[model samples]
Target: IPDDLLEAARIDGASEFRIFGSIVLPALKPIIVTLAVFTLLGTWNDFMWPLIVLTDKDLYTLPVALAALSREHVQDDELMMAGSVVTIVPVLLVFLSLQRYYLQGLLAGSVKG
Candidate 1:
C-alpha cells in the first residue's frame, strides 16, 4: 500500500514527506504496532550479528552481553542469568502488548473464505 501510494504520489508531483504524510503513514498504522513489536523482539534477542558488529561495551545489545557473560562468568553465573532475564524481558513485554494484533494478523493471513 505504501509503495503503490508513493508511486502514485510521485507521478502526481507530491513532495517526499508530503507523500509519506498523505499516502503512506496513514495506511500503515493498522499494521505498524505489530511490526514494531516484532522488530523490538528481533533486535533485542539478536546475538551473533550484534556480537560480530558491536565491539564496544556501551553498544552491547543484551543478547550479546548475555552470551559474553555466560562464557566468561560460567554457565551458572548469576550475572549471566540476570543477563538472560534482561534479554528476555523486552520480548515478553512486546509479545504481551502486541500478541492480540499478531494473532489477529496471523489468522487473517492464514484464513480463507
Candidate 2:
C-alpha cells in the first residue's frame, strides 16, 4: 500500500513479482495471516452448505458429523458436550496461535492515513 516503496522498486528495475515478493507481500503479512485464519475458521465451522451439497456419508465435515451424532444421541448430554468441545478446540487453537497477527491487522486497519 506504500506507493513510494513500489515506485522505488520499479526504479531499481525489480520485476513485478520481485516487487510483490519482497515488498508488498511482507507489508501485507499480518493482514494476510489474519484473513487466512478467518477463512479457515469460516470453512472449518461451516455446516449447512456442506450438509446440503454432500450426500455421501464419508464426505461429511466435522460439523455435519457432529450434527448427525447429535440427532442420533439426543438424550446424551455428555456425548454432545464432547462433540461440541472437539468441534471448537481446533478453531480456538488456530485463533490463539495467530492472535498476534489478528490483533495487528485490527490495529493496522484502525489507523487513519
Candidate 3:
C-alpha cells in the first residue's frame, strides 16, 4: 500500500499529504469508492450483526431499523422503496464520483493484445 502510494508520492513530489491529495488518492479513488460503497451497503443491510450488537431498536442502524420498520409496516410499498433509496444513494454518489478511475484502471489493465 505504502509502496504504491509512496511511488506515486515520489513522482509527484507534492508534500506527504499533498502527494496523496494530488496523485495517489486520485489514482486510488475508484478502488476506495468501490470499497466504501461495498462496506456501506454491507453494513446497511447487515441484519444479524446489528441484531446481536444492538438491543435497543432506537439505536439500530439503517438496515436493522428498516427491517424492523418493514415488519411493522409490511404493507407499505412506498416506505420500502424509500428505504431502498436511502440505502442506495451513498453507493450511487460514490460510484458516480469515481467513475473515471474505473475507466482508466480498466483500460490500463486491458492494454495487451
Candidate 4:
C-alpha cells in the first residue's frame, strides 16, 4: 500500500474504516484470489497425506478414492479415465471462475512509488 494515498485520504477526512474499505481491500483483491487459488490447488490435489491419515474407506479424498478405484479395476481403462475426469472438473471450474483475478495477479505491476 502507498503511504501517500492513505495520508491523502486522511487529509480529505476519510475515516480509517473508509480508507481500508475503499483502498486497501480493492488493492488486495488480486493477491487474495491468487493465494486462495494456490491453497485450493495444493489441498485439492493432495494425495499422500490424506491417504496416510484417514483410516476409513468412506472418508477418502478424490485422489485417494481414484487410486483405490484404479487398484480395484486395473483392467478398466475407460473407468479410470472417467474417474480422472471427474476428479479434474471441479478444480477446472474453480480456476475458470477466478481466472480474471488470478491473471491480474500474475500480470500486476512491480514498480515502486
Candidate 5:
C-alpha cells in the first residue's frame, strides 16, 4: 500500500492496529517469508551452541550427533560424506523453496536509505 493511502485511512479514522493488520502485514509478506526461511536454515544448521549445551547423548541435535558420528567413524570416508549430506539437504531444500523471497530480502536490505 502507498503512503498516501495509509495517510487517507488514518485521516478516515482507521486505528493503528487495523492499519497494520490490513496494510502493513500484507506489504511485509515477502520479508517475513524471507526471514522465516533464513531462521529455519540457521537453526537447522546450528552446531556449536547445541554441542556446548546438550551434554546427554539422547538430547543431542542432528549436527551434534553427526559430529559425534564423524569422530567415531574417522576411518570411514563414506559415512562422513553421508553425514554431511544429511546436514546439508534440509538447508538446500529450504533455500530452493524460498529462493525468490530470500533474494528479494537481500536486495531490499542492500538498498541505502
Candidate 6:
C-alpha cells in the first residue's frame, strides 16, 4: 500500500487494473479474511432476525430450529445436547479451517508493516 510502489508500477507502464490486482488486493488480504471470518461468525450465530423473517418451519436456520426443538423437548436433555452439537460442528469446522488467516487479519494492524 505504499504510494511509492504504486507510482513505480505506473512509471513501469502497468495498467491501473494490473496495479490494483497485484498490489491493492494483496495488501487487502488480511483485512478481507478478517472481515469474512467475522461475517461468518455473526451470521452463523444470528437468531432473532432469522426467527422473525423466516416463517416457514422448513426455512429455519439451525439456531431458530434448535430453539423450536428445545420448546418441544424441554425435558429431553440428551436430544438437546445432540442438537447443540449438530449446530456447532459446522461453525467449529469453518473456524478451524480459516483460523490462521483469521488470526493473521486480526494481528495485521497490531504491528507496523
Task: Give the Cα RMSD of candidate 3.
Answer: 5.6
Compared with the true structure, what per-residue lDDT tens digits does model 4 show for residues 18-61? 99898777778888887998999999989999999999999999
For candidate 6, lDDT tens digit of each residue in 18-86? 988977776678778678878988998899999999989999998999999999999999999998999
Q: Candidate 5 regions off by >4 Å?
A: 8-18, 100-113
Clashing pairs in 5: none
Which portions of model 2 show Cα errors greater than 4 Å? 1-22, 103-113
Q: Which of the predicted structures, 3 or 5, would earn the higher lDDT when compared with the native?
A: 5
Cand. 4 Cα-lDDT: 0.86
Better of 3 and 4 by lDDT: 4
lDDT at 24 for candidate 1? 59
Cα lDDT of model 5 by residue, 10-104, tens digit: 99899999989876776677878878887987888788998998889998878889889878888999988888898889788877887776555
C-alpha lDDT values of all predictions: 0.70, 0.83, 0.73, 0.86, 0.78, 0.83
Per-residue CA lDDT of candidate 3, range 1-113, in tens? 34654665577666777866765566676687678777876866778887898988889977777888899999999999999899778767866876777787554322222
What TM-score does structure 5 among the candidates reach? 0.65
Q: TM-scores of all models?
A: 0.54, 0.67, 0.60, 0.76, 0.65, 0.69
In the order shown, what is each candidate's alpha-carbon RMSD?
A: 7.1, 4.0, 5.6, 3.1, 4.8, 3.7
Number of the predicted model whose lDDT against the real structure is largest: 4
Candidate 4 residue 62 Cα shift, in angstroms, is 0.8
**Poorest 10 consecutive residues by lDDT, candidate 3:** 104-113
Which sections of candidate 1 miss by over 4 Å? 1-32, 102-113
Sequence-dependent TM-score of model 2 = 0.67
| lDDT of the structure predicted as candidate 6 | 0.83
Minimum summed lDDT over a 10-residue window in model 1 is located at: 104-113
